[model samples]
Target: MAKQWLNKVLELGEVKGGLAWGRFLFDGNRWVTLMEQAPKGKLVGTDYHGNRYFENEGDIYTRKRFVIYAEKRTNAYNPTSVPPEWHAWLNYINDYEPTTFDYKPPVYALKAEVTATGTPKGAWADPDKRNWLKYSAWAPPSSGARGGKA
Candidate 1:
């Protein structure tokens, strides 16, 4: 009864918005406590991005499934930022969850935002030079040259 009421209330948007509030509702006792009542599987693992993954065998409403919940970080939401590994798991590539399996992010993978002043060695910097001459028409060779051919 309480769970049903909570669900109805959330559907009405009474819980509130924003990252902090959403986090509190989804991860806090308000939501988790209710979710616990429902049939849920084990939590596989969380990525550097703070997205949690979960799975369970065939349930009443659906078959083996994958679930993800975003973190409550200050940064605004960006669905495209999800890493490939997590994407594969979400799409059902393997039965085993990444958290349980041996998963390591590649060394070259982008980890964080780049600072403006800190241009680490080997990093490519824009020369800022433009090839505007290419767009214009070609010009003939100079007359002063010693070339015999026109």
Candidate 2:
């Protein structure tokens, strides 16, 4: 949180990948956590985007599955970074692992907000709303509100 505030004030922009996370070039804490969890879990598979999935059946009641995102922490926090097939398995929608070869989202699935934003597909998002430092009168359009219809 402090880093985000500092970035905005200094116009330094967002943190550069994971290097800024710890004293080392890599995320030390994550590495440490993984080292500890290594024995309790086994890697499932890596998705097309390089996100690694793991399943821990060490205990039947506490069995769990999770993904270690390949994207930087900042990018990973964005929900859109996780694709649908992976999400399905993570959420128990499907017990089987998805084949990661050339994984393309289904036509019905929405595109990532980062890709959709500032594009026709995500016109609903208002950049002004994200600009907390600036005052904006922008209001999201209601159903049939912006157009002449209603």
RMSD of every prediction: 12.1, 13.9
State residue 39's C-alpha deviation in candidate 1, in Å.
4.6
Which tens-of-lDDT digit does each residue in 20-116 have in candidate 1?
4665565544354235422345556777766555555545433345434353333323455456777677676655566667767689977643234
Residue-by-residue lDDT tens digits, candidate 2, 18-84: 5554522255544533444434566788766666777877645434776666654432234455677
Top candidate when judged by lDDT against the true structure: 2
Task: For each candidate in the order shown, give its overall lDDT on alpha carbons.
Answer: 0.52, 0.55
Runs in model 1 lying further than 4 Å from the true structure: 1-39, 60-63, 71-77, 104-150
> How many steric overlaps are in each model, in order?
0, 0
Cα-lDDT of candidate 1:
0.52
As a whole number from 0 to 100, the lDDT of residue 53 in candidate 1 is: 54
Worst 10 residues of 1 by lDDT: 68-77
lDDT of 2 at 92: 82
